[model samples]
Every structure is written in structure tokens, then in C-alpha cells.
Target: MDKKIVFITGVSRGIGLEIAKCFSNNGYFVLGTSRSDFDLAKVLSSDECLHIQLNVTDRNQISACLDQLKEIDKVPNVLINNAGITKDQLFLRMKNEDWDDVIETNLTSVFNMSKLFIKSMVKERSGSIINISSVAGLMGNAGQVNYSASKAGLGGFTRALAKEVAARNITVNCIAPGFIETDMTDHFQDKDLENILNQIPANKMGNPQHIADLALFLASSKGNYITGQTISVDGGLFMS
Candidate 1:
């Protein structure tokens, strides 16, 4: 049997990086992407894992990247849309560019990626596409209207696409994580951190591995029946 291939974006660090390592360690070939180049030696030590530079928001770049993957006969059996950005601001103070940037990077990029990869999966009659969303999209955050909107959009996208591809045995799902201990959440002020901690029943921020492990399950054979679901790995911060 051929080794399964998993393609992941925003893999330079954080949840994305951990996801890559998780799949690679499990004996899958991992194709990891980041907007900027990083040391592959540190990010993914295995030769089966390759790091590629890609800006997920750029449609042309996405197409080119897919074409390159084709040349290598390494089209992925799983695609994880894990690249995202946050521009936290009160709605009254938010700039249009900020909103656009967040939407493009977070939500629109998923559209681009899924469109490109779904055809191959459909033809193969099997695949998993896991999108990394946020708890803010479900519970909403005070100064993150843009971020919330983007993540919420992903939930809808995942459900609709799951239905579309279910007949083909292609599963689509979203994982909405709460305050994971990533660089994205490292900027909180002391008081703000205390307030956030007070709201969580777990009383602690989650690690990237928490999200990675969930992603691994969703991408594995164990998750074959799961589709159109937005699973939360937010340490009981927001219960649906």
C-alpha cells in the first residue's frame, strides 16, 4: 500500500507545525506549507515531510503549488487548512483593510484550497479535508468581529462541502479551537489572560498538540464516518 499523503498550510509554527509532525510521525508523507520559508530541519525532521513556501491567499500561488505537487505525483489524500491571522479591534476602530486581510487569509483561502484539492479527492473516491477554525467564531469575542466572521464562515463552508462530497467518500470538517498556547495568543495582557482563564472550566490554555491530536483523528480511518461537523477542542471554554 502507498503511504498516505497529508498537505497542511501555515506549518511554519504553532498548531500547523504540530499537525505536520503528528502526521509524519504516524508514517504519512507530509507536505507542509508556510508563507515564509523556515528551517525544515527543525519544523519536520523526517525526509518524508517536505516544506514548501506558499501564501494560501494567493490564488495564483495556490495553483502553482498544486501544479508542482502534481509533477511530483504527491497530491495529498488529506488537506488541512490551518493558516490564519487575527486583527483584533473594536468594530468601531477596525479598518477595512484589516477586515479584508483577515477574511482573505482565514476564510477565502480555504475556498481556494478546497476547490483545487476536492476534484482529485472526488476522483480517488476518498479523502479528508480538515479546516482549523476558532471558538471565537462560535461564542464570539469582544474585539474580534472580523475574526469571528471568518471562522463562522468556515463552519458553513465545511458543512456545505461535506454534503457535496459525501457521496464520493470525501469528508469535510472543521476544528474550532479555543485559546491554545500558540504565538497567536501570546500577546494577551495579564488581566486579559486572567479573565480568559476564569471563563474556562479547564482553567488552562490548551496546547497545540490538543488540536493536532484531534486533527489526526479526523484525518485518520477512524474518522471516516465523521463529516459536516465542527468539533471544538477548546478546553470546555465554549460548549455547544
Candidate 2:
């Protein structure tokens, strides 16, 4: 069997980086993208992995990265849209730029990426697209209106795209992760952290590897039947 080719965005650190490493270790040809040059190179040092600089906020950068992938004949079997940002402020106080930035990075980029690659997957009649949403998308949070909107948009995008491409054997799904231990969450105060944990059934922060493992399965053959669903990894934060 040919080795799978996987492309992941925002893979410099945290969950994205862990997912990249997991795919690479499993013998996939992993291509990871980051905005930082040094961090991109550092994360994808192995022969099985290639790192490229990509700012999803910039269309030109995304196009350039696609061109590089085409040149190398590395069309991906799995495309993980994990790049995102948060501009947290109450809805009333949120600046226009803050809302636009979050939408561009987290929501619009998925549309761009899916449009770019879904055709190829359609032609091949097999592929998987895993989007990283958040539990905040499903359950609204205070001071996170923009972030919530972006993530919620991703869920809609996933379901619509899944319906569009289901006959072509392409699965589109979103993983809505809860509070995970990463640099992003590290910014929370101890009190805030404790309050958040108190709501989780597990009563602890989820490891990055746990989310990575779920992503891996969703990208693998075992997940062929799964599509148009938002699976939460938030230790029973919201049960629906």
C-alpha cells in the first residue's frame, strides 16, 4: 500500500504539532505548515515530514504552499484545517478588525483550502478532511464571540461540504476540542483553570496527544464512514 500523504496547518506547536508528529511516526508523508520559518523547520525535521511556511490569513502564502505541494507531487490524502486564532472580547467591545481577523484565519481559510483540494479528492474519489473546531463553537463562551462564530462556521462548513462530496468518497468532519493543555490555554489564571476543570467530567486538562489520536483515527481508514459530524473531545463538557 502506498503511504498516505497528510497536510496539516498551524503545526508549529500544540495540538497541530502533535498531530503532525503522530502522522509522521505512523509512516505518513506529512507536510506541516506554520507562519514562523524557524518553528516550521523545527517541527518537521524528519525525512517523512516536510515543513512549509504558510500564513492562512494570506491567500498568496496558501497558493504558494499549494504550488510547492504540486511541484513535489504530494497531493494530500488528508487535509487537516487546524489553523485558528482568538480575539477574545465581549461582543459589544469587539473591534471590527478582531472579528474579521478571526473569521479570516479560522473560517475563511477553510473555504479556501477545501475549494483548492476538494476537486483533486473528487477526482481521486477518496480523501478525508478533518477540521479542528472547538467546544466554544458548540457552546457559547463569554468574551469569545468572534472565536465562537469562526468555529461555529467551521461546523457548518464541514456538514455542507460533507454532503457535497459524500458520493465522491470524501469525508468532511470537525473535531471540537475542549480545554486542552497548550500554550493557548496556559494563559488562563489558576482560578479560571480550576473553574473550567470543575465542569469537565474528567476533572483534568486533556493532553494534546489525546486530540492527536482522535485526528489520526479520523484521517485513517477506520474513519471512512464518518462524515458531517462534530465530535467533541472535551471530557463530557456538553452532552448532546
Candidate 3:
């Protein structure tokens, strides 16, 4: 049997990298995209993995990446839209550029990528699209109006698209992670971090692997029946 293929965005570091490794280790052909000039030899020196420099905000780059995958005759069985950014500032003080930047990267990119890939999945009649959202999108956060809005848009996108593609046997889902320990969260102060921890019923920061595990499950056959859902992997921070 041919190995399943997965294409993940924002995979140079953090949760995206972890997810790529998880799928690769499990015998999936993994293609990872990062905007950075990543040393693929140093990071993912494996035949099962392909690393490409791609900026999700750039439409041409996204199209180019998809073209590269097509060249290999490996249409992705799963597409993880994990690329995102946060420009934290109060709504009143937020620059228009910051708002547009976040919307384009986090929200608009999902629309573009999903639209591009859905046709292939529809023809094959089997695929999964996992979107990485955030708990801030569910509960909302101060100084993160732009980031929260983008993530919230992801939730709506996942649900609506799931309905559109469900008849074709494609499942669309969103994973809203809470306070995972990554370079992005390293900027928090000790007290602020502790306070955030206290709010989590699990009383701990979630690891990137934790999110990766859930994503793998969703992509696997076990998750075939699931669609139009947003699952939170945030250590009980927000119970729905």
C-alpha cells in the first residue's frame, strides 16, 4: 500500500514541526513548509520528509508549493493549516497593517489552501483538513483582538466548509490549542504565566506533541466519522 501524504504549513519549528515528525514517524510522507531559510539537512534529514521554504501569506508561494507536491505525484491526503501569527495589542492601538497581516496569514491563507486542495480530495473522495486555531479564539483575550478574530474566523470556516465537503467524504476540523509551551509563549512573564497556569484545570502547559497526537488521530481512519467540529487540546482551559 502507498503511504499517506501530509502537507503541513509553518513547519520550521514549534507545534507544526512536531506534527510533521509525528506523521513521518508513523510512515506518512510528510511535506513541510516554512518561510525561514531552514537548513533542511539539519532539521529533517529524512527521505520521508520534504522541507520547502514557503510563506503562507504569499498566494504565489502557496500555489508554487502545491505545484511542487503535484510534481512528485503525491497529492496530500491531509492538509494541516497550521501557519499563524499574533500581533498582540489593544484594539484601539492596533495598526491597520497589523490587523490585515494577521487576517491574511492566519485566516485568509486557510481559505486559499483549502480551496486549492479540496478539488483533489473531492475527486478522490477521501481526505482530512485539520486547522490549528487557539483558545484565545474561543474565550477571547485582551491585547489580542486581531489574533482572536482571525482564530474565531477559523472556527466558522471549519464548520461551514465541513458541510460543503462532507458529501464528498472530506472532513474538516479545527484544533483550538490553549497555552502550549513554544517559542511564541516564552515571552510571558513568570507571574503572568503562573496565573494562566492556575486557570487551566490541568495546571500545566500543553506540549506540542500533545497537539500533534490529536492531529494524527483526526487524520487517521479512526476520525472518519468526525467532521465540522472544533476540538480543544488545551489541558482543560476551556470546557465546551
Predicted structure with the largest TM-score when compared to the true one: 1
What is the C-alpha RMSD, rounded to one decimal, of candidate 1? 1.2
Q: Rate residue 63 of model 2 by lDDT.
A: 80
- Number of backbone-clashing residue pairs for each candidate, in the order shown: 0, 0, 0
Q: Which regions in candidate 3 have their CA more than 4 angstroms from the true location?
A: 1-3
Clashing pairs in 1: none
lDDT of 2 by residue, 1-240 (tens): 154999898888899989988888888888888888745445556777788877877878778778888998998979999999998998899999999999999999998887778888988999999999999999989999999999999999999999999998899999999999999888899899989999999898888898899989988888889999999999999788
Report lDDT (CA) for all predictions: 0.91, 0.88, 0.89
Candidate 1: global Cα-lDDT? Answer: 0.91
TM-score of each: 0.97, 0.96, 0.96
lDDT of 1 by residue, 187-209 (tens): 99999899999999999999999
Cα lDDT for residue 206, model 2? 88
Residue 28 lDDT (model 1)? 87
- Model 3's C-alpha root-mean-square deviation from the true structure amounts to 1.4
Error of 3 at 6 (Å): 0.3
* Candidates by lDDT, descending order: 1, 3, 2
